[model samples]
Target: NTAPRPWGRNSRNEVVVPFCYLDEETRKSVRDDIILAHNHWLRSLGGTASKDSGHGIKFWEAVNKKGDPEYCTLGPGKSWNDNVAINTVVIRHLANTNKLSAPIGMAHEHQRPDRDDYVRYICKELKDFDAAFERAKRADSRMTEDALCNKPGQAKLYGFRGEDYLMGVTASALALYWPVNKVNAYDYDSIMHYPTLSGDAKEECLTNEQRCHLVRWKDPGNPNDRSVAMVKENLTPSKADIDWVKATYPW
Candidate 1:
């Protein structure tokens, strides 16, 4: 699906499409667009900031809180990548999806919406999530890497692309991990407790239409049992060798 570029930096790199899905021209065009966009952002931010921050050290920074970026003519991630420009980079997952890393959700639409404030908001949010994750990591290591860069799951607070940070870790040996077991129209415990799927725990109590959404992807338990009935029985998380989630947690 084609998505309209927002008023800010283009997040094309975040798309899940593989190389096969995009031609070389399309990729190049996207990259070029990113560069052009980045440069514009930089120029708009009062040029650059070059200061000798230390012995044999040079700190060159061009920031605009409204739409700060690492390099304006370089590409689309300036707001989130530049020093405290918009959001802080927290790899939602490893380069792959299993693990998780995402830009810490630190931007306040109002406070950071202005050009100057954008930089400050990004900086603040970066500091906020980094500190938050670091602190929580002491108790649970996963909390450090696999957490929303924002206020946990606060993406629900406002309707935006804040949750784009999610990437899949090593794909579950889906065939082996999640397989259809049984479809319950009104069974939340079955779907939620299956250890392989995600659905309303109280789905069994829903009507036909409502129950249909009570999807549950469960571990196949046995890879060889990839039968249609078996998959259909499982329902929401079908075992039809498609869209299966690996049962193993990347951690």
Candidate 2:
């Protein structure tokens, strides 16, 4: 667990650490990726990669106040100011598996202090889609409300009532420290998922990521860790997750 945890250092010279547990490799990868991404962003700024607009350097310097205030990553052992910090990032690790997960952590979209706004927006959008679909129904096809979302193993609309909710609770706590907008759908199969917690599985649970209830039955691994919830596995984002991203952050 000595892996370097990198986060977006803000103008205030601080970062929102997820305090998440990740294996050595994934953690390192994330740290490296952040640096690379930030560097890439810097190179793209002022229009040319070759010319260090000093913007990239300045940006990282402010965000990366971890290791050295002056040198950024070029300073010494662990360079804290190495990249452009992205907000609302969620760092996650699995409990007891060799699952190869990505370095980028995810932010919980459901528990944004603005949670209600997202729900309203998504619900309205869905209703609008429902109406549009009805108008375009094929001459020989009959579309039912269930048909719109009742796939073999998916939730009807946005998992309005299920494990997505439970996992969201965990994300909420983690997100309090991060700067994020709350208009995202829940990700059941994410590293950020509660290890042993989930929403109402019976209502709208995916076969692979469903759970029966939303209680903290046991502490993760630390007996003294009185925390009620836990994360179980490494859940890579699914197609549904991608759809959520598109909906929330429209390109």
Candidate 3:
């Protein structure tokens, strides 16, 4: 993905998709298209940014009020690898809606149209009631077609625990819909998974449709499950995540 042509100082030494190899007019047009998109994004933010100084900032301030100093820095996130810090308005919107991270502001992945198909497939194929509906009940007690197929924001807010597991399933599901292609086998260890909330007292009542509190990648494994433990603890992405990001960006 790299090409050397004295393009400029790329201190990051990141993979460079060589668009400059095109004709001069083509390169200029590509740059112009980027600028046009950027300006359009800024104009969209202007509406909320201008309304009240604290509206967006205040949202973050309140959300991160009790966190550490670095956690409370209210601005665009730092860039890493070849990824740029595009904007913060989307981040603000995520916080406002109670989602941990979703730059596109999609509140939940269970609400995606595709996931409905997945659920219907599960209902038809997985006949083990203890393995299917029972587990589904723990995942989201609401378990209704509407609840599973739509964003149950208020229901989730009052019932589910706001932790890595809760957000992991939805976020990981959302990642599937990213323009990025599938780079590897589905990762049960992905942060976008719900924890095995079986014995947890607080999660005992959550519905499968509401948040069954349990999510998996491709299969449910044996008694001692590492993926289940991963959801409960640190959910840093595994090799699958790195591959997914690289493939998605493909610079």
The numbered model that scores best in lDDT is 2
> Every model's Cα RMSD, please?
22.0, 19.5, 18.2
lDDT by residue for model 3 over 1-251, one digit each (tens)?
22111222133333222111022233333444433433433333332222331112111211223542121123335322122222222211111112222332222332333332222112121112234334446776866533432333422333432222222233332223222223344344443323344333234224342233333323332332233222242234334433433333222
Rank candidates, lDDT, best first. Answer: 2, 3, 1
Show how many residue pairs clash in every candidate, following the order shown. 50, 15, 19
Q: How do all the candidates rank in terms of TM-score, highest first?
A: 3, 2, 1
lDDT of model number 3: 0.30
lDDT of 1 at 67: 41
TM-scores of the candidates in the order shown = 0.18, 0.25, 0.30
Is 1 or 2 the stronger prediction by lDDT? Answer: 2
**Per-residue alpha-carbon lDDT of model 1 for 1-251, expressed as tens digits?**
22211122123212121111022233344544434433432232223322211111111234456743233223333223223333222211112211111111111111211212111112112213444454556545654233443432432222212222211111121111111222222232211112211221223323222222212223322222122111122212122111111111000
Give one digit per residue, the lDDT tens place, for model 2 in 19-44: 22122344555654544544443333
lDDT of 1: 0.24
lDDT over C-alpha atoms for residue 240 of model 1: 19
Off by over 4 Å in 2: 1-72, 77-106, 109-187, 197-231
- Residue 160 of model 1 has an lDDT of 19
Better of 1 and 2 by TM-score: 2
